[model samples]
Target chain A: MADRPVSDIELKAPKGDWRDAHVELRKGTFSNASLPKDLIALGLPNPRKWQPTDLDWQLPPDWKGILLRGMRERLAKYRSFRLFMDVCVRCGACADKCHFYLGSGDPKNMPFARAELIRSVYRRYFTLSGRLFRSLADARDLTEDVVKEWFYYFYQCTECRRCSVYCPFGIDTAEITIIVRELLSLIGVSTHWVTEPAANCYRVGNHLGIAPHAFKDALDFARDELRELTGLDIEIPISRKGAEILFVMPSADYFATPHYYTLLGYMMLFHEIGLDFTVSAYASEGGNFGLFHSNDLMKRLNAKIYEEAKRLGVRWILGGECGHMWRVLHQYMDTMNGPADFLEVPVSPLTGTRFANAASTKMVHICEFTADLLYHEKIKLDPSRNDEYVVTYHDSCNPSRAMGLLEEPRYVLKRACNHFHEMPAKTIREYTFCCGSGAGLGNDENMEMRLRGGFPRAQAVRHVREAHGVNLLACICAIDKATLPTLMDYWVPGVQVAGVHELLGNALVMKGAKERTTNLRGEPLAKETANA
Target chain B: MATPATVEERWLAAAATVSGGLIAAHTLTERDPFRNPIGHVLRRNLAALVREFFGAMDEAAIDAAFGEIMALRSIQDLSVERAVGFVFRLRGIVREEAPQMQPAEAEARIDRLAISAFTQYLACRERLADLKLNEQLRALGVARRRTAHRGGAPA
Candidate 1:
């Protein structure tokens, strides 16, 4: 535990004629070193020395040509990318909107400045004015330094699209970032943090590489926990064919803390409603780290979910709580790998509810599913079971911004807990901030950057903590479950973090169950412990 | 132009100039002065700092005001000189406006502010460094756990 909780507010001082110095520092367009071994392990095609600070990135002789050609190909292929390249006026609305800029004070971290890193290169190669009058047009030739800048700043972006929400032209900087990352990957310049997971998800059917039997063992372990907690015999169907629904979740839920409790929540909910669902060991992961790497890889990993759903002969897919997973599933999944003509649109078996929102994708969010059940009062909930916590929901960037899943989680929270408060309006829903470690940036090497980027979210969390005396920070993102605990421990100590379903697991009234004495973490309940 | 007939009026006019200077110094890098939250913070903190100089502002209030100012500035690549220099800007104003006020007394107050500002700025920088270190350690811990899971040496 930290000796004292840190606040970003205590560290500011006046600029006092120091703008030039700071501006010069930000213009360098460099990043802290990347490890060679991690890159090697990920099998990124390059023999370069991995350290960014070394300044010798060890690119191929034709690296400039490769990057330029890749950019040209993308300009023709993606109309959105080309339009984004053409439209930015640098009006500076997006300058302060980026959490990275607000946190790091690096001008390059500003969306406009970050775009210029690529736009400058785009101008020099693609535009007539840029080629003829380079300096005046703010264009520069593609060089090793420019390539290094791309590698550094492009990775800094989480592609949360908060900047787009505020942009007058409605330019999606996230798409621009995706294009740059795709262009960079052409020359085999990619981060190990991203590529490693993409490789793992490709080879082993999950990011963690948990084999079929191992995946079963994890489900079985959750079942045992359910038995011990609710004293109910819960059967977790593993790759069972002809099940009514196919459930897919981030593999982290099967493996990590807070998330595992959320997994328990799913089991308890399923058992309570007596719904038939199958968990697939084959499509064991819903998270596509390939979204962070390239679009093709995202499509490649996403194919498994539909394939597993089809093989199982399930009517529809029910996705668990995750961040980027939903972003791909909601926006890109159908277009990239679908027409899901084989699968039926999702409807709840117990509640007899049809999910019209998810009719096209044939996949329903577990929150939407649970929220429907609660709306009709199908499942009995003991709201007092979660009296121990005063909760605040963090709108995970991808889910809130990409999917507009703002209401469903809050509905679940309203039914599950007695006390709930929202973060400031500007920071939630469509304008939500990233977890600072999203899009495969959640590595130890980039921890400072993450902490800095996370400050806006943490600051809002702190506000509710101070104002409402809120203690538990509830969010839907699996990465939030793994990472926010660390972030809260550092930034807002005393604010415990949990998933919404973890609260649901606690509040759930199971049939013929013994008197519950503890919540999902096995920490004693207030009533039972007080009586004891 | 007509001059202020009284020393007190002259002092009040000079104080406005100092506060304006302080707010301007804080907002130099901000692209949108009105929309930026930090600009508001500077305006607020400069208001409080000016109050502390002329009014009976408590030590805690002074500290709280500086803390807000410091937090807004924390994002910048701040040096010790740049971080606390605004606190010293008042010294010149005090000497120029209220010469009747004790120079030693005013210098002492500025010195006190400089110390507070520097201490807060250092703490912020230290916390940033610590966060980076902690993140590396946490990442290493995760890596170690992964290694252990791979049937290698335990973390």
Candidate 2:
């Protein structure tokens, strides 16, 4: 690491005086330098070392042509793209709603302002009013500064769609960000946090780039840990042919802390229910970083799951707890790479419930699957096992807004734990704040922005922490599992982050299992108190 | 004979003027803590600082209150002077609110608070720098481990 004093670190201080605070772009909030190797290996255009702060981004000579052409193509193809561009009226309903704006107090971080970075360019090239009136119509010529602004602001958005919930015209600002990012990718303006993960997901089948053996080793480690805690030798099938269900999750589930405990939860739950499922090494990652990049790349990376399902001959798919994975799978997967007629409609073998919501997609969320199980009383849960935790659920953005997975995780959480609290009405469910690090912004260099963006969510968690002595934050997204821990550590120091399934695993009562003394983390469980 | 609450209000008003331009007027006035965490953080910390200065002069409590505000301002797009200068703004508020208090003692306390605020601001900046370095190292470590598992040269 470079040994530089904190005072010496260059911050992109906002230009002009404090009155310009609204448009002030902070230092350290822009895209990190993309690794040349990752960019080159991915076959991205103009693969070279570039930082967002550089004066000249070394754009292709016809960069304007590329952006306009990309925008025109998307405008013609996606009605939502065209509609979002044309519909926004500069209303500020979404201004205060955005967690980034609320956190940073930067007006440019507001959804409308962020969209205007692209909309102004869109107007100049595509609309007649912009062509004639230009500056009067609030349009500007597409310039390098505009492209740099796009790279900075678009990456700041998690594409969480919280703004869409508040838009009167229902302009999906997240889609605008997506289109702009796709356009920027054409000029090789992408972040390492995104490109590296996209490359890994493309080649190694997971964002962590964990090879097949390493994937198995992580699972094996979880299995040994589980056995030590529960004394049940759970079978974790990998790429088993003719399995009834093909299980897929964000690679972090098996590889990272907190998410690993959720992995154990899934294993124990599947074992208790006697469900036949196999995890595929080829389709190891459910979370698609490509969604943060370009649509074509997203489609390319997403094709692996159905292909893996076909190769394994699984009847249906059971997805693990992931935020954007569900967003892509629920919203974009079938349209992009589907006609998944090869797989059957997902039916819970334990509860005999058919997931008609996932009929066409043929993939059921683990929370949905578990909620169905708990509803039908298929798995016995000892809620007291989780009495030590006063839990609060954070609705991970994509899961709540993009996929409308509002109640299932909460339903499961209620059954799995004795003490449960909700973070105030506005901050949960559809109006949920992004973890601030989602959509490939979860990298280390973006730590300051992440903390700022996550301020709203952390503040809510702090509310419940003080109100109810809540010490555990439960969520159903893998990114939430990975990032909320850092947010909680920074803001609400005593609170811990855990997956919903991890909590359920703590409360699960497996037959012939050893007397449990601890939760999945091997932390000793709260001793039973006598009331007699 | 201003009560503690009255003095705290005066001190907060002074701090707000220094930090006010950083956020919108509406956001600075937003009562909802979750909606305007920066405003909430500022109000909460400034109040705590006022209480510490007027009350028992608990060095630790005063340091923590200053640290909380500085932690936020350090990460924001403020120059070091603008970030910590709010502490110095409290001097006039203290003089007007407590005329019976010793001018020399109050000045000494305010001076000490300003220095502590600057120290806290630097510490927070260092924490941010460390966070960046640690995140990069963590990512590199993960990449290296993955490469080693694949029996390839480390990435």
Candidate 3:
């Protein structure tokens, strides 16, 4: 039973070519999606390996009703609905903003067009004419056929929240999409990645199927890498209760490639600042995949983070800059799991400035934290040591659009490295395009469409590489870490992807530790930030 | 004679839920997307309504959704405004007859019944799609002029 997770594994690269993905998508046949199968599955698609063995649903039964009512009423009452309903003139100002529309030339991919899909329902359900007459002006009804179409398209959304940024009224359709996904979960339907990790997190406490011993071993690996890279005896301050900070990172880091190295970078940063931070084996997973499945599961998955936080009695909780994780944190975290009292909003000890808006817990993005420390001159300098290659930044969709984390990362890169190149505005900073793989679309199930969507962003990077000799691409989100390698290798050849914190690790002047490898040791030192 | 609400009010009342400016903007233009957008709006909304109904509503979720609907205390206070322009603009003989029948109690009941029937009809149409089987929809008859949906997934 213990080994069930390990034996039941299958990780295939997404099938089909991405360019043709949109073509197949337009036809509803490209991904070979099965509506019936999806409807029957509970988040995890492949039940044998993915089905959670942990029956430990430990809910108080009544808590489910409270959460459901709380979220439902809040959504039903959100001001954004009114804003979305009232805002768009449909002048098509947003027609070109979407990566999917630009990539496929499909007008339906327009953000307003998608919003209308929900807006129309809102009209039908709420208006007197929709209710009392055949008036074309009001509400509509939910039909089974309508369910299938939503299942198909809602999954396509990538939930980028990009549309919200450009919407003059701050209308967030991503909320609508999340609500729809919650509704879908109620029907016992879910995709594998969304459900699988959620179950893994609940069952084993880590999404990578790691036990405590394995988790400890991963930490040891990071420590050894720290020794080789920094020539220092840096132990990852592992799982100690009553620490000042409980840093939460995506489990993918502990189980996968550069994520481990990114962890090492944080450890070095923590040690340098003389802060008390601990990793938790109880709630090790960062809970990004929670939003991908059902909001019911999203909340269920999110609840564990606070549960552990309280159990450990930490003053501050730091989160890694993961894409969906930030989306949940920035957009829904406060509304769902909040009133976090022990933490006083992450303020840099060096800068005396707040890490982020109080709305998204006082937690700081690693880049923001590192940059603040640098700005305050808390770290010793050797900025030009990373001068070997020109670099550019891929502003991840979540940090830039969802939370407006544009300048802090660029600030870090500018100060940490010697040669810095900027991608065109459309590809960098606030207007930065999504990596073709935002959302779970990076999966092999839809990799074909992912590749196509990735084209424009890849082309943007290609231009920087050709025009400015850019070799390293720094982004803060871990999902980007998993995805950009493919994008750079396939489209923007000769460039590598990295965490902003990583580039800082190379030049960081540790008090007790020697300077580490140029790249954060998330992977072996051989894996340069450049494309393989 | 009971006066009905203006067509604009009837439209805005519900259009108020999703977006006001977009709806108001559409009100200014004769060819607005709400009335007739480039893609099929009716199909799109119907899909969303179902997605919302099921994705968010179990029996408990439905009750919660219903509770929310009921919670809008103002909705109950709203007077059912008639579309006087629509009544006046009715085609041919009915246009003249509708105004002529003015204030008759019988006409008012029929009008009320029609409103109830229409609202119920929209809900019935939606539920038929949700249940899908004819036997499941024993109350909604094929003889009832009902349209069979293509089920929206790839045929």
Candidate 4:
């Protein structure tokens, strides 16, 4: 057992001429199955041991019935789902827009083809032309093989909505992928990379399953590290009721590298501004892996934030640098679990600027908050402190596309760093390529796929690295912080990944603070000084 | 003796042949490295490999060049034979371009290079397999430590 590969699935390289043969469906590229414990904990069906390579998935007896009914239910429920199902002209506008398709050269990775995998089934089950004349109408029955294909291709999508940008009909292929994943979940088919973290988030209030005490310990460790770096006792309050604001960040900020530096920056910034904010261990996480899994799970996980906010009696929520966290907060949070009548519209206590945009959600992005502070000249900044890094910003997909947060992060980056360069205009802003590991596809098993998906982004980074001597790739997403380092190391070495706030934390000129010898990572501040 | 230009031409011919119909013509023609990474990586590394072969015969340089090529090919759908066969194609090019340059030594060097390519290929495959297990263990370890800190049993 130990001698065998961790997964029985093997990668099948395309045979003969690849264009002629078409890229074969590789078995292991799909993510690992959700563990029974996580499945049960999430109340997901069929809580049993299984692998994607397993011949028998041990699916529910009436999985086909369940799936058809699931399709019928969703089509009736979401107008966008129905419109998308009915809309795509298949003019192939989005065929070349996908990074996955471009990198893998797999025809199925194309957004339309991926959507067709489900749309075909949807037609066969629901539509009249498809019901009577299945093959003629390009409709296929919901066989196990079809289900398997849906699992393979749908998970391949990062749901970055890049394809939707190019579609003349504005067909959101990502919405199709999400609906297909929801259908898959009806029969107990899902990935551990997503489901496990989701279960952990549900059970322990964070994806890493860090309990309240451990969460506190991580904060305490960061507090100590901050003290060592700068001679200041930064206060990190947790679950302190009656605070004016509630601070929420992806749990990775506290637990993961490079991300931890961003956390330290937040601590320093909040301390400098003297903002009254409290962190809640119960709502310790901002990232909702549930967004990747299902809407119910997304809601269940997201509910904790507003619940914690109300309990702590904070004015409004302040979010940290995360991608999909912003997506759920911006697009879905208000509708799913909102009308936070208890909390006031967020007014930056320091800047006196109200976030009129977040009037309904009442949750302000950290970049917006900091950008406001910089614009008002409320905070002292030393851009030279980040002189060592030739920085470039990677607009994480959700923050850029879902929320249209294009300039705030870059605005903050320009003010915080001495030098800043952007990737190709096509690859930045709304058109930004995904980290290739988003939508819970960042599992180690899926490394090759992630590398392939990440190729375009890495290729863009490589260009800037050679052209501008850009060494630091800063972003505002925890997943990007966690995964871009691996991507950079693999494709373009010498380029480091960091959060925008980490750079800000380094350049922040805190009042009454000692001269800083090192940046937040505890490395020396200046390039020449470090070399010496 | 073959000039650097002639060696580079021969190398490009061999790589194009090895690529077969797998890579798109537009992708190969695309000048932007970001738009056509596979083409860029192939051109850069293959040129470096040939240069290292004729000039310094630097083992490390040859290995680094091979590593980049194989890193890509290993993930691709090409079989082991086709994946490493591109190395042997260079032997024919070397023979045709500079027949008088000690054919026997050149053939031996090319054979050794092919072996190194195979080794690199296997290493990439091994890395792919190990990635899954390593990631699982890493996550488990973090979870276990956190549980331990909370005075709970191993998760």
Number of the top-ranking candidate, with DockQ as the measure = 2
1 against 4, candidate with superior lDDT: 4
How much does candidate 2 score in TM-score? Answer: 0.91
Per-residue lDDT tens digits of candidate 2, residues A128-157? 999999878878888777777677778889
Share of native C-alpha contacts between chains A and B (below 8 angstroms) recovered by candidate 4: 0.10
Q: What's the DockQ for every one of the candidates?
A: 0.11, 0.27, 0.01, 0.21
Local lDDT at A452 for model 1: 63
- The residue ranges of model 1 lying beyond 4 angstroms of the native Cα positions read A1-44, A211-214, A526-532, B1-76, B79-155
Candidate 3 error regions (>4 Å): A1-79, A82-87, A129-142, A345-356, A511-532, B1-155
> Tens digit of lDDT per residue, candidate 4, span A1-532?
1111112212333345211212234544668899999999989988889988888889999999999889888889999999998888889888767888767766677798788877787888889999999878988877888888788778889999988888999898888888889989999999999999999988989998899998998888777777877889998999999999999999988886768789999999999999999999999999999988888899999999999998988999999999999999999989999878888999988879989999999999999999999999999899898999999989999999999999999999999998899999989998898889999999777788888888889989988998999999999998998888877877788999889999999999998889888898667879549568
TM-scores for candidates 1 onward, in order: 0.83, 0.91, 0.64, 0.88
User: In model 2, what lDDT does residue B72 have?
Assistant: 76
Question: What DockQ does predicted model 3 obtain?
Answer: 0.01
In order, candidate lDDTs are 0.74, 0.81, 0.55, 0.82
Question: How much of the real interface does each model capture, measured as fnat?
Answer: 0.05, 0.23, 0.00, 0.10
What's the residue-level lDDT of A411 in candidate 1? 97
lDDT of 4: 0.82
DockQ of 1: 0.11
Worst 10 residues of 2 chain A by lDDT: A1-10
| DockQ, structure candidate 2 | 0.27
Please write out the lDDT profile of model 3 over residues A88-116, one tens digit for every residue.
Answer: 67666665566654443343457787666
Docking class of 4: incorrect
Give per-residue CA lDDT, model 2, range B31-139, as digits (tens). 7887778778877887787777877778888888887787677766667877777677666666776788899989988888888898888888777766555444433
